[model samples]
Target: MPLLAYWVTYASLDRAQTDWYLFWRARFRAGEPLPTDLSYIFLHVYETLHGVGFNRPEAAFAHLQRLWRSYRVDHPQLDHHLVDWLADFIRYYDLDDEVTRAWLDEAWVHAHGDLAVHYWLERGGGGEVPEGVFQHLISYRPEQNKFYRDAEDKAALDTLLRRAVVLTDSFYRETTGESVFERLKTKATHTVERRAFSGAVFEGPDFQYTVATIRQYRQDGRLSKLLTQAVRHAENLARKQVGFRSLLRDVKLPANLAAYLDVHLAPALATLQPPSPVQTPPAPERPRVQLDLGRLATLQQESEQVRGRLLEETEPGEASTDLEPSISPAVPATPALPAAPLAAVHRPPLPAQVAEGELTEVDSIAEVLAGITDAARDLLRQLRNQGWEAPEGDLRLPPGVFTSTLVDEVNEAAQPRLGDVLLQQQDGRLVAVDDYRNELAFLLGTPEPAALTPPLDGPWGALAGLLSPLHLEVLAQLLQTDLTLGELEVFTTARHALGSAVLEDLNSHALDTVGDILVDPYGDPLTLEDAYRDDVRRVLHASGLVHPE
Candidate 1:
């Protein structure tokens, strides 16, 4: 309907001119009859007759008469259709009649009076059959039975005969107080004793019909598609394994379908193939960060700046004679009054940390250490290929880094890694944001360098942890084997940590932390100097970083 509407709406053709319509137009206009085998007519007649029964002669006779009237002798094609239709009409109807009479004959063989047949025969009222018609039925039935038995083909009503016996066995058991099984056995024995086993009683299983088996029996072409669909359903249900579906597609049964197919197909079906496996990828490498205070001094001077500021104070009255000794500023201090021109100098963005002038003796030392720290971080970043080269000059640090209270803040921030020792003598504040990268060896305190701890992560008694991340890794590498400073730099590269370089450089400067120096790999009583040298020797031996011996 949608197709029809689409054509009507879009194409708006005056008429359909497909081959069928065009040919039909010529034939009708020319007064030519439709060919019997024209696609339409054949389908029409064949479809019309499919379910019309041929169970009786009268039925076929009526159909034949109808066809005769419909056929026109002038139209040989239509006449030919009637002829084929009649031939089929006769075969089916006659075969049905023959089957009905044969069933009756089996019940009344010899002179056995079957009240059912006599009653039905009398009701059929053919007036009088031929004198020996009853005899003929008897003789024909036995003869057919003989032919069937001789050819081993007496299965015509094998199902029906079994059905009748089942009914009889039930009747005998239910109505006569006899066991059904015993009654069936008794019937079978009598038949054999009478020497009448041709199509006789025997042990036969009750016949069951599946829709598929019925379709196979009929050999129905249209039903074949439906059967194939059913087979596919079975196959899918079993995940396309063998067994029932395999036997269903067989042309005919051999021996027994269940037993044979089970033997062949069950095992095949049971062995279902599994899906294939998938592969996984490898892990990525970690980032490397190592600090070096000495190399940093090379980048920017003022190693003492942050250390100086760390001790400086911003609070009122904290500046003393030692720190505020006659200092001058670009702007004068506010007059000693609330309404003065300005109460405080709105200082520019202070040094990256603290003001150098505010620094005290202890803060001065911390500021220098802080400067060293800043330089180290810078150098490590550069090594990571940040590509920020240090400008050549006196290592003067940038100013804002030394804001009045800022350097102390930085010292406090970096203290966790460098330790409270780097803190001002007054308030030992920790400020290292990421202290994990600091030299942990001092935190876990020991005379022996090997006693150099990794990091005090948790309470692990007697096992002092090194807080310096660089020291731990470099130590780990040295533990692997000895290495040198120049070589230690290469070890730093492979370790992929700027922290490794940071540890090596600290030890290299020999001013703080372990370095590329030599000592017992074990925690032998060695100063930072000796341990530093041992690491340097190991790095050298490993041919890690290239430099003169």
Candidate 2:
């Protein structure tokens, strides 16, 4: 029968009526060369078998394989169509196992590369295929295929890009002994194939994987985008290093690829110049008060004379007897008080009431004041006369002396002996803390002001007096809220003291006065005992060391 007649008869027959083997055998044996347009026959047969369902995939695949092997040589043009249909049959029947894959490749995988890739990808695109086959499959850029075009595939691409960066960074580190990624260690166990690229060979077990992945992107016309991203990533990795440009220059890539990276990375390199040193403005000059010493002496003499004249006019009889010297030689006259002595005043002799070996509290405070500079005494005197708070300008500071420094000097001297800051600067005014007002007045020889808060009596009062200023400040902060050792250190460190020592001192004093430790020294966050919290608070409040909440 004519080829056309047989083809028509085959199409007309149902599966039950047709003998696939005998029918094709007769045509093959006819010896009239197979027609170039025999793909219809292959398609018709594949459809017929597929319609029979995949209940017997092996039989169906074997039948298609037989037809392909039988006619593919005579009808070379039909080979592409037949192989495609057979691959589709194998895929549709889920026969894409090692057996069928070998069968399909032997049939035509070499001649039809795209179909081979499609077949492989349809099988989830994993496992080891022939290297040449893999190259051909990846060469087609399967990631752009509709089946692989999703976030998962994009992530795969990103993963490959990152591997490339790490490999490249590893290459630089190995060749130049410098790290581009700043990684101290690497998992690159594979020795570099020295001649693989132009400059340096990258490391890592994934080197072959990275090469294939990169080749796929390169074939997909995305190499530039990939390299640009890689260059930017490397730049970020090396941004903090002083040798970024050198690191980039040492990147082990082919000349052209390295040049491409350089072009993209040049703009960032230009901006990476070492940062300029910051310039600080100089402090402004202070105006020095140049005093006329002779004129000051004349003014002082005039002021004293005016003061004596006014006193005589107000009480002539008392003034006469007080000012006149005693006539009798046997009875010595009491020496008059000296004029306002700014320069040559001496510390008062220890009071007779103070025992020779022991320093009384008043004498100790006086000693603290006596150790301070004349400027500090003057500042204290002004604060005392002005109700313990006065503007900085009214304090009569000496030339080149600042009110803050003088106050610090006085507080430092007093803190060691008196155990508290005698003076503090607030709102540009020198002020004495209310708790120390009486002591400050007596130290400066000023009349004592009425106490703002009455003194704490009994053990609480004694404990308050015994506690150092740092201890009180720490206690005050704890009274508001319990403090950690770190928080307490902030208060003590400025005073060159330790928080633990302050607590120890406080507990020691509490033992002596309250007969029990007030603060729980072993607590994580130091806390006062519940029984003594109120009493401690009351003592601090009454002494004006700490105020009511």
Candidate 3:
């Protein structure tokens, strides 16, 4: 119809040529004999016949017969097309009769199928099929499962099939009170077995598929790319190791295909071998981070500023008195009558500060300390909530696993390793966010503190029951080995924190250990400073896990 329309509109032919083209087309459509004048029109009619033939074969057949009658003798080219179309019809559907036989005898042999024979069998209402030609009609093994490249994959498939059979057997026996295992086994063995390329079942290697079809099957959706690669590798292995050339001798395939597999495919598969076992991966190296003592020093300075502010707030009335002596001048008593102007004098209110909930921002020492405390606690809670536990005894974590509230400069400059303490900057002041000393001691690998006191029932009570975090850390280390005074000082930053005030606090908690350190063996008591440096170490070791060696 479209070709007819094109000629009518665009050909610009005379009225006679237009009528002649229309007459032939109309004659073909009307099932009338095509005029002898337009003999070339048979080819165009056959092309149209093929387009509409698959569903309406009877109408297509009428056109086919007419076309064949017109050109089958002289125009063998048109006969070739007619034979090919008939072959397709025979392959896909049931057809028979003298007309079918005539076309079947003229069919072309191709890679596809036995088109003529299949059509004859279907059209004759089915009969005994000849030995090898139409075996795919009964049951066909998909090219995907014909052969496996991987031995492991083949084994897995076999296991799945056996399990499926067992499950089906169990279901049938329970439901029907009869075991169908033997019957199903025989049926599966006969029907599911793959046919050899030559149509014999048990005459060739287990795999009978062409590499071309295998490649196509591997491109399918269910198989992953990795699986496809493995299959390809297995195919290569089987060709070399399984004696593919020797196996191909027993089977039948196209000469070209067999030659390609042996000459091209065999060499390719041999080169693509599995990896060697000797090469092992190296262990991963961890990143390093530097701790910033400068940040801690700045925090200490901010703490001192906060302390000064707190002292002034506590004695607000004395603030003016303290300044009065330095002023050396005072306001006269005459100012009492000029109170109205003094009251009217505009003193702009303090600039509004950023607020969060009920807590408004304040430029005071106490508020600064409070902010530090809140930030520290919030950070600690966050780390804990995110599964960062306070490990006992020398915690060594990966770099950046636990984050600190330090400024970007500090964080970026160094990668903080495990066992490093974290500090946060709050309101321009740095404060300890987590206690690393005891946490390190409590880590799984570190030594435990001497259980001097009775074991506590809870995590907090246990930590609080022991010596302070610093002392606990010292004890954990000392338990492993004794260290000289200089070595101990170098081992930790806590040595600087072990001043008289801290010693006194420790003495209050562990009175017996402190009392023993205060007195000398000669009955004279040592000074607090000397006692801390010398006697305290001895006394602590005697009381705890550490013993002088």
Candidate 4:
């Protein structure tokens, strides 16, 4: 089902309105709340975060939080629950997982893109955005084509995108840079190819069996449209092979005879002498002529048999020997040894008071206003002192015309903190430069790296420092660590049941099964077909349809 319910709402409600619309709407809708729609949106939020497990968690949470905050201000009625959800987000954040990055890749990064806008209008806000306050909250992703965008509150979507890039880069470094793919192939292959080169294909199952399996998947909605297409292709290829076999069998030709005939038969036939028209010597032929009807019948029977076999031909153990063998991916019958319990990933079960934390709320708007103003002044001084740093070959930011890149770009209400920044640029210069650049810049008059210390702030700060938008993604990691360490029996039981190898095992499994299940694109962009596969998987997993495998 779609994330939001389809309501023929006012088409023009595209911006955040501070007016008491949510309050009145809540009263009007009352019991008939948009539960399914709300849940759908949450699931999308959840699914995207789950994909971040392929990357980072804290970063992911930071992004989600930004979105939650932006979308929830005018949605004050939902804020209480949403805030709780946000807290939970921090609780379950995992630093190394792709769940965090997944949210951005699938949603936030593209939130304001034109496509997101259209999606929101055509899909999301069947209801309109309220009419006031943070009206500009609605941004468009030209990337997705100009469409009405969705925003409940006002936070910077561009900021979320920048943070997402950093988180993605970090994930790439962790999962790909230092022998990740090699290790995955190495480890996954080692586990998968245990019965290596036993020369078995989808052992025991014949082609009919494979075809039957695919057909069943289609019937059960387990196979997506794309996968169905692939299955059809495979079927077509098999059928063609059968046709070829039948032609060869009936044509009474050598193994290569068909090709030879196709290539040379016509030319050779051209060289043949025309039929002689001379009167026949009839007497000699009439003497011994006898028709073998029985033999002809036997020959016809043989041809029919050949055709039947050809239609159901088998290629033996050719392809799929190593990929998904007939015997399950990992034999459930292996009688897995009761291994030590792995740690459980959890919502911060720590008492709310304890888990609640010291990252003081943005305190008050007054403090934010002062801090933002001071940061802006300090930033200007820093900019002037540092001078333009854009490379000459690159399209340059004109000298002295300070571009609001990172913290400087943020309004007086949202100055980035030390840890909140992953990276920042100044006139195309790295504002939050890395250690190497910090060292180089320090030597050449740059400032000290703010994040050189362990990330001291909350997940949001760490995200800014680290660069991510998923709210509390860092906290999620902390929670995951505790979860892994906690001798929780439930976590162990869950992992065993799901057969997971990662912290976000259930989330991963959700992706695994749901990732392949897609609604018909119904003539959408071909590239989106791939993205939709990813999206559906994430959504399904988040919704708990695809359990962890």
Cα TM-score per model? 0.14, 0.24, 0.17, 0.16
What is the C-alpha local distance difference test score of candidate 2? 0.51
Tens-digit per-residue lDDT, 163-257, candidate 1: 22223334445566873333322111101011111111112232211101000111112222322332222232233332211111212222332
Per-residue C-alpha lDDT of model 2 across residues 345-395, encoded as one tens digit per residue: 345555556422123345556776768877777777877776777656556
Candidate 2 to truth, TM: 0.24
Q: What is the lDDT of residue 161 in candidate 2?
A: 29
Q: How many residue pairs clash in all the candidates, one count each?
A: 81, 0, 15, 67
lDDT of 3 at 16: 74
Query: Against the true structure, whose TM-score is highest?
Result: 2
Among all candidates shown, the one with the greatest lDDT: 2
Q: What value of lDDT does candidate 3 attain over all alpha carbons?
A: 0.35
Model 3: how far is 352 from its true place, Å?
Answer: 31
Taken over the whole model, the C-alpha lDDT of each candidate is: 0.31, 0.51, 0.35, 0.30
The RMSD (Cα, Å) of candidate 2 is: 37.2
Tens digits of lDDT, candidate 4, 200-271: 111222211000000011121221222222222222222232231111011122233233223322332233
Worst 10 residues of 2 by lDDT: 207-216
lDDT (C-alpha) at residue 287 in model 2: 92
Which parts of model 3 are misplaced by more than 4 Å? 1-382, 385-466, 494-496, 499-505, 512-549
